[model samples]
Target chain A: MDKFSLFVPNFLPCREYFDPGNNNACPGCGLALGVRHVYKAADKAMEKALWENISDTKFFGIKTNPSLLKIKQKKNELIICLDNEAGGSLRDALKKQMPGMAVAEGFKYVATACPSYPFDLYDKVKKALDTEGKSYIHILCPCPEGWQFDPENSVKAGFSAVETLAFPLYEAVCGFYTLTVKTAKPKKLSDYITIQGRFSGVTDSEIAEAGAIVDKEYSKLLEKIQSSYSYTFETTGKVY
Target chain B: MEASSGFLKKMIKCSLIEEGTAKPYKSGAHRKSLPEWDRDRCIKCGVCYIYCPDAAVYRLDDGFFDVENQKCKGCGICHSECWFGVISMVEER
Candidate 1:
């Protein structure tokens, strides 16, 4: 049974899982954007690592596992990649369960408005990974498909979202989390809403209300990063 | 084709706005009380004729653009492209 708790997982991330013609029409679904972004990020990371260590490391093909539970035998490095859905929460529970594995949670990896992982939840997972000497990179990919926008507007929406603090762009290293791009104050939520079709139902007044929610959330996240504390490394030197 | 000296109007479909709303001819700028048609001022350059995307402008045998005002979407393609700036897009409101 799929456990549903604090985290939500986009279990079906593969294009093959999608039927050519389905009865359910999810035109502005953000989950699809999250899957595509994760796949792209994985490819880029592997390529960068390979180029950096051409002589020392060999390129190996990756197999997609339903659950990323396999322990690295000799390399002593285990990477767990998950979306910001129930599956990600399950992974977080597993991290609490297994002390030997390191977990990295992706945030806003796909949708401009909908972040992959809850920003607060991501903070905790990122804290755990850093203490283990593991690297955590949060990807924020905006999707015009998810936003119900003209497909061409994806890149513009993506940039605006970051600048507006509708989505925060930053990296967490070790125990320190810093905002790479800072906005003095969150921009009007309408600036983020009118461009996309998913939020087309949103009115000018409702837009103001939604903006308040976004601003409150962004403020809380900023406060958390500003006052971050050092986290204890949980996993033993089983692999390291 | 049967040629008429009077205005022959047609409607175009645009998903962006309300359907079946008959907009006046390019809407009502081509009617009289607008301006004098100076044939000498016009070079018969065919700029307006070639520039209208909707084919709303046609050159008559008399060496002038016969603009089908009702058929024009007011897209301003002709007005902007005209080297002589003879064509203008008036406000619909």
Candidate 2:
């Protein structure tokens, strides 16, 4: 299959974050390993989506964040948008390199690897990208390996992330927003912390602090869902 | 003919079962061949546990070491952790 058929734009692949020599990693950082897994999974997903239609797929990279521009429709093409939390400055740097090119006029969809935490900020970013109609936005989160948690607790972390607001699972199209909520309760962060080495030094009080932040964030998400129309998304899988 | 059969019996006595748990020798001079465990010298620090990617040596409820001979690939991590020579890796008798 022609794997890169969607003009797949990549931010930074996860492997870089886990390199032992990177020095940025803590002794027990599970998040680094988790990120590597998720990136591989996401890549597989995108690849599957592209290869399934290889006969007509045309992959491209904008090398710019979707926030900066209104993407003009290109005929018979699937565009992939990518960004990381490292900062928006890198996107600006890319735009500056192409002095005449602006980001606002470029992307149709944006995908984020970061969890949607502190929902207010997530909303502002979503609004910036949804300007040209409803767009595909994804927030992939609660990575067990990344957060220094057990690999199995990822789903629990996912719910905690959304419920506590440390992460929110939602998609926004145009001005419409829908929050994804599963019936399961968020598991204790302690259960998640034991498997990973990163949180080894975190004190109980600090964990409590993290919990409060998550709780506040989740409350906001629930409020948003109750106030807006809800839609269920059933279609998700690796595409290549 | 009697001597040949006796020699065969001795050889059979020395043989190990195909899949039984390997343990320290029950008695006699051959017992010294087993790996030594000096608990007083052990700090119970668990470096042997952490560095053991295979997780061969694990802690027991009574707070002692337990070896899984079947699972152990005979990696020298336990031997390496014994700075005071509490544990040693030895060949099977």
Q: Output the number of the TM-score-best candidate.
A: 1
Q: Model 2 over residues A145-198: C-alpha lDDT tens digits? A: 344454334434443434434444454333234553443566665554344355
Local accuracy by lDDT, each model: 0.39, 0.39
The list of candidate 2 runs beyond 4 A from truth reads A1-166, A230-240, B1-93
lDDT tens per residue, model 1, B1-93: 344322232323323255443332233332222111346666666544432323345557775666555444444444544446676545543
Candidate 2, B1-93: lDDT as tens digits: 999999999998877757553344321222222344677776554434433323345666765565655344443445643445678767775
Docking class of 1: incorrect
lDDT of 1: 0.39
The residue-by-residue lDDT of candidate 1 on A50-144, one tens digit each, is 11222332212333222221112222222333322232321131122111111223221111122333233234333333343333333344444
| DockQ, cand. 1 | 0.02
